[model samples]
Each structure stands twice: as C-alpha cells, then as structure tokens.
Target: MDPPSSSSSERWLWWMDDEKKHSIADTIDIEKSEDGEKIDARKERIRDCMTVLGGFLSIMATGGAINSVGLLQTHWENNQLREYSPQTVGWIAGTNIFLSLFVPVLAGPVFDRYGHIWILAVGSGLFVVGLFIISFFDNHSAAPVTLGMMISSWGVLCGTGYGLIQTAVPGVICRRFDRRRGLANGFSSLGNSVGGVLWPMLLRVALERLGWSWSMRAIDGLALVMLAIGNGLMWGSGVPAVGIAARPEPESSDNEKNKEEQEEEGREPSLTWGQCIRDGARCFRKGDFVWMTASLAIFQFVVMGVAGTLPSWGQQQGFEDASLFFYVVAVVNAGAAAGRVVVGSISDSLGRFNSVIIVQTMVVIVGFGIWHNVGTNERLLYVFAALWGFSNGAILGLWSPLVGECVHTPAPDHIHAIIESLRLLTELVCGVSRLCDVENFGRYLSAASSVVSIAGLLCVPSSAQILGTLGPDIHVIFFGTLLILSLMFMVMARVTFTGYSFKIWRVV
Candidate 1:
C-alpha cells in the first residue's frame, strides 16, 4: 500500500491516542489545499496589522500623557500651584500615576470577557473630559486651578481612563501574537514614546503662546481624534478561536461525539463568586509569580518616584534655564521610545527574562555611576537622562509581555468549578483562559497590576518627602537602593522560572 499523506498520518496518530483528547476543536491546517492555507495566512496578517495600528494610536494618547507627568509636576509648581510645597503638589501627580496603574485591576477582567470596545469607549471619554475640564482654569483666570481640581480632573479621571486603554492595548496584542509578542508590544508602544516627545513640545509652545486653557483644550481635541480612529480599528481585536493551532479539526465520529457529551455532562454548571476568588488566590502560590509581582511593584515605585521629583531635583542642581527641564523630559522620553523598540526586539531573541536581567543591571549601573555624580554639568545630566530613559523603556515594554510568558504554563488543578473558570484559571496564579490560551490575558495582567499599582500611589509623595528631608544626594541613594531591590527580585523570578537550571543559554 502507498504511504498515507502527512495530514492523514497525523490524524491516524491522533485517533490512535486515547489520552490526547481535547474539548475545543483545533485550528486545522489545510495543507492539502494550498489556496486555503494562503488565504488564512493573508487574513491573519491583515488582522494583526490593523490591531497594531490601532494600539499605536490609543497608547500614544494614553501612555504619552501618563509619561508626561514629570513635565506637569514642574509646570504646576511654577505656575498654578506654586504656593504649595513640592511634596504637597507631588500628591496631584502621584494620584494620577496611581490611578493610571490601579484602575486596570478592574478593567482587565472586563476586557477578557466582553472585548475592548466598551472599555476603550469609556476610557477615551473620561480621558478627553478630564483635560477639557482642566482647560477652564488657569493662573490668569478668576477661578484658578486648585489642587482639588487637578486631582479630580487630571488625577482621577485621566488616570482611570488611561488604565483601561493601556490594559486593552497589550491584552489584545498578547492574544493575537505569541512568538512575536515582544516585537509587536515594542512597536505599538512607540506611540507612547512619540506622544511623550510630542506632548511636551506641544504643551511648552501652547503654554507660552495660548495659556493653560487653550493648551489643555488642544491636547483634549488631539486625544479625541486619535482615540476615535484607534477605537474603530480595534473593533475586531479580541480573543480568537484558541486551540492547538497546528492541529487540524477533524470530523467527529459517533464514538468521539458520545465521549465529548459525557465529558460535558460531568462538568459543573456554574462557578460561584467564592470559587473565583479562590482560583485567583491560587495563582500566588507559584514562587515565580510572586517574585515577578514583587519586581514589578518595585519597578513602579522607582518609575513614579523619579518622574514625580526629577524636575525639582534639577532646579535644586542650579539649572537657571527652566526651558531645559522641558527639553530633558522630551529627551528622556525620546530615549525611552528608542529603547522600547530596540530592547523590545532584543528581548524576542534574547529571552524575555534574560532581557529583564540585562536591562535592570544597566539601570542600576547608570543610576549609581552617572546619575549620582551629575551635579552641575548640563551635558552629564542630558547623558544620564538619555541612558536612563533607554534602559527604563525596556522595563515598561517587557512587563506585560513577561506576564504573558509566565502565565502560559499553568499548573495542574483538580477543581470542580465550571469549565470556563478552570480554563480562565489554569495556573490559578495569573489567570489564563486555558492551559496556554491567550483568551484571558487581561485577567493575568490585572492580577499582576493589582500587586504593583500601590507603589505608584505612594512612591511620588514619599520621594518628594525624602528629597525635602534629606537632599538630592541622599534621595539618589534611596532610589538606587530600590533599583537594587528590584534587580534582586527579578533574579529570583528568573531562577524560579528556570527551575534552578545551571544551563544559562536556555530560553525562558
């Protein structure tokens, strides 16, 4: 007899194996029909492009604004909230940073189930409205901007909106692309960097020429346009038909159908609220997950801590030209944008966990070697900003993708909950829809965010208080120690992930 075709041979093997049953149908590779495969490949590429483009635009508006908090801190202190102490004024920016990360805790699970449309809509609306409200008050007006107004409009509203948009962008990207996930996230994140560069320049010019009212309104208008177009493109971006992508879907025999029916009958009808909490808690049982969360939380603290107080530290360093501070913010973000793309691409090849170890080491070296010594040298300050931004960009770009990687391998569980719940919580540390499915990336991401966002909330004000009480030199050491702490946690996470293997070349 002639040898069977490759597809037929695979099917024969699958049929012969009784232990290899799956509830979901697999993605069929119609290799016998070349035309069908070509069409599917073409369609998949097109969809991926649309999603990336949409993510770029949305993240530009959200991430760009969030990254610009350092600039805002300097502006408010000099113009509107000048009378307030730096530590007090830092609260406004701190609250904004806090909400931007924290609100995602709620938005993540919602995005996993319902898709990105409604959440993005709500996020876009809140974002624009916050800026619009802020436009009405400035120093020259009868009703000047107050700390309360800034906190409510800028901090709470804009931050919450950004949290949703930020979550949705990475969540969809992770779902669509697995192997090239780091590249996709890095490229789309360029929007934030671009926004970071552009927003500072735009605000500086607008503030000088048009005053605060018009400047806020201008950003509000631009954000609305960018977000609207982005929302349209991301309409179809959500959980796809998840299964074994290489396996062909075969016609079910009578016996196979009966077996599936019996399996379905044995599953629970529904998962209760208590079960959901229990499953979420189980995710923390993994040492790798816990270490990763600790590292990210410290990362958040370092980022917000620096952004909140960097401008004030510059002023203290005796920089006479205030405009230079704005330029520094722009340049830092420019370096960050470059870093996200470069290091992000590198992570794809170098392994995400390995890249983390490398970048964090660079951060610690720069933090002590350069940043600690740059006193009055403007050139050194600029160099530090560029180098720090580049290294820090990797942290932001790789974080969600790292979570995606960690959540891919779920531990065995014997829970009797609904099939949906089990799929969503296979590892029970970070929620995965199935053992390795991308459907519930949001839940995994949210679980990680919840653990880290508190750092964002407290770090800014705390940093300012430290700067006030001790001085620039002491503050630098404080933040540097935090970086070391973060690096230690990342190392521990890598060790746990690798099962303490001595082979360093292994791709995590």
Candidate 2:
C-alpha cells in the first residue's frame, strides 16, 4: 500500500480513545462554516455600532451637566449664594469635577467584569436623585444646606455616576470597533460638546425665568428620559466579545501541539485584587506609557481650567450682560462639537498622531496669537472663543484613539483599564491644584496651564496683572508653554512606537 489515507488515519486515532474522539468531533461540529462565521461577524459589528450610539446618548447627558457647571457657578454667584465668597462657592463645582475625573480608575475594572447595564442604571438613578435633592434646597436661606446637598448629591453621587457611565461606554466602543475606531470614538465624544452647547443655553434661560429650584428639577427630568433611552440601547446590544482576533484551527497534525501551546499562552489568568493593583502600578514603570499619561494630564489640566473659567474671564473683561457671558460658553462648546466630528473623521485619513500634533499647534497659535491681544474687543473675544474651542475640542476627541494606538496591546479591557487609571491620576492632580489656591481664581487658571506656569502667579497680582506686562498676555504664554510640552511628550511617544520616519503616514 502507498500510505494510509488521511481519513483512515483519523479513524484509527478516533478508535484509540472513544471519549477523545467524541470531544474532537464535537469541537469540529461547533466550529462555524466559513460563510456562517462571516455572517455572524457582520451581525456582531452592526450590534456594536448600535451600542456606540447608546454610549453617545449616555455621555451626552452626563457630559452636559458637567460642562454646564459654569452656568451653575454663575448662578450661585449672582443669585442664591451671592453672599458667599467665590472661593467657597467654587469648591462645590470643583468637588464635582474632581470626583468625575477620579472615580473612573476604580470603575473601569468593575465595568469589565460586570457589564455596562447595571453600572449605567445605577449612574442614571444617582444623577436624577442628585439633581432632585438639589432642587429641594434651592432657597437662599438654605444656602448652607444647598452647599451640603450639592457636595453630597451633585459632587459625590452625580460625579460618581457620570464616571461609571463614561468609563463603561468607552470600554464598549474600544472592544467593538477596530478599523474605524477613530470615527467611532470621535462620534461618541461629541456627546460632551453637544451637551455643553445645549445645557448652558437651557440653564441660562431656566435661571432667568424659573429660578434655581425649577431649573434643577427640569434638568433632572431631562436626564431621566435621556438615560432611560441610553440604558435600553445598551441592554439590547449585549456584552462585547473579548480579545483581539479569533484564532483559526491548525491545518496539520504537526501544528496541533503548537496551536494548543499558543492558546494556553494567549489565555489571561484571573487576577486577584492585589495582582490587579500591582499590574496597574507596573504600567507606570513603562517609560513610553508614563510620557503618554503626562501629556494627557497636562492637556486636561490646561483645557478644563481655562474652559471652566471662561464665563468669569469674559465678565471680568467687561461683558456685563449675563446672557453674553453665558453665550461665550455655549459658543465655545458649539465650536467644540463641530471640531470633534470633523477632526475625528479627518484623523481616520491623516493619522491620529498627526491630527493631534496639528491641533495642539493650532491651540498654541490661537492662545498666543489671537487670545493674547483680544483685550476688550467683543468680536475678537468671540473669534478667540470659536478657534480655541474647536482646536481644544479636537484634543479631547482624539485622545482615546491616540492612547489606543500608543499602547501595544490587543486586549480591550487591559487598554481601557490603563486609560482610566491614567485619567484618574491626571484629574487628581488637576483637582488638588485647583483647590489649593481658590482665593486668586485667575491664578488658579494660570497655574492649571502648566506646573511651571503656576510659579508665574507668585510675583504677579493676578493673571490679568501680568497679561500686558509679560508680552501681550501671560495666560497665552502659560497655555502655549503647556501645549509645547505636551507636544514634545506626544512626539516622544510616537517616535517610540513608529521610529523617526517623517514619511510614514500612520505611526500606530
């Protein structure tokens, strides 16, 4: 005989052990046909896209409230808590910001294990409850009680809820889309910009007409409806399938043992809580990741600081009309929403790192070139608001995709965990920095631009005091320096990933 036929050989192997033969046969039976697998994969992608849409709604609601804090700050100052110092009132908003940034570090892992629905459910409930509580204590006489309610309900409860939703939604997106991740992430992040734009205008009108009490209840009611829709969409999408690419079976007997070994190697062992902590700590030890984290931290610190204080800055510059001051925030956010969608789509072609570099450069020019000499020119201020918002908004929108690119990993949970941890650390630093010097609010804004720039505050009476003195504007100098530093670190990260090749189109 020439040689045993392949079928004969398999039959011989099958007869050697009945249990092993059945196990092998069952595995083969369970494996999908080629066309069937493709069909399933297409279905999964469609589901994931729907899930992303749900995530967008969730972010829109939470991001709206967070971004609208400026309006609330103005309301407190002009109305309910006008008797209190700005510093005292600022802490209420500051606490909420701090918690929103910081809680995600812990929530990321919980979301990975538990799934998105319950996390979102609890978050939605807390957000609604927080707003309701605040509504009850809106009277000026209950200023002290309102402050307590704001901190407990809005700051701790609502912030934590937003943090959970924010963390879980990104995790969902990261797992679902690989090829078109930039577009997916960008679209989802648009929730923040849209929320920022709409909420400020709504709150402005509510404050003017309804007073603080009804305004709080109206917002609460709105959040409840949006969140219900979001939760429903998320529930329908189901949990995302984990890991990168699915493995194909070995074609030959010689490869079977190797394939088994590869499978064993790829399997991630469950980690204890201590091991998880240790693993998170180990990520910081990597030089490239550390630089990436630093860049993100500095960017957030600078942008949030300036954006948060824009209303006050406009007022101080003699925009006496409350409506005009509120409009400044809305205009910036509207530009931000537009920038997020446009730049995000462009990044798919230009490359994420290249897009980030260009935007950062634009921010530097806008801060120094336009904003520095804006003075009391209302038109110039609006121009600065539009350009700065658009460029800065792109930075926030692009960062998730950039972080995904820099970290060399196929596991979405691991990547998300790392991102959340870095964000928490960045926010913690920003929050503490803001809280320390609440007295000179302008100095806090300057200090937020860069760690080095905060030193500039020591000698100057205020941010405005050093504006014309040190070139056309001190704030621009501080912001530009931060952007330069952030750009340097980002380039270092890019170089580590793709080497120094200007011709290379995509670094990731």
Candidate 2 regions off by >4 Å?
1-50, 174-185, 240-267, 409-477, 491-508
Could you tell me the lDDT of residue 87 within candidate 2? 52
How many clashing pairs does model 1 include?
3
Q: Using Cα atoms with residue i matched to residue i, what is each candidate's TM-score against the true structure?
A: 0.77, 0.71
lDDT for model 2, please.
Answer: 0.66
- Candidate 1's residue-wise lDDT over 381-466, tens digit each? 99999998998887877887788776776443344457435334544655322223464454567677777778888887898889
How accurate locally is residue 226 in candidate 2, as Cα lDDT from 0 to 100?
A: 85
| lDDT for each residue of candidate 2 in 384-430, tens digit (9 for 90 to 100) | 88988898778877765665554443222223565556645754664
lDDT of 2 at 284: 52
Q: What is the C-alpha lDDT of each candidate?
A: 0.77, 0.66
- Best prediction by lDDT: 1
Local distance difference test, candidate 1? 0.77
Q: Report per-prediction Cα RMSD to one decimal.
A: 12.1, 12.9
**Number of the top TM-score candidate:** 1
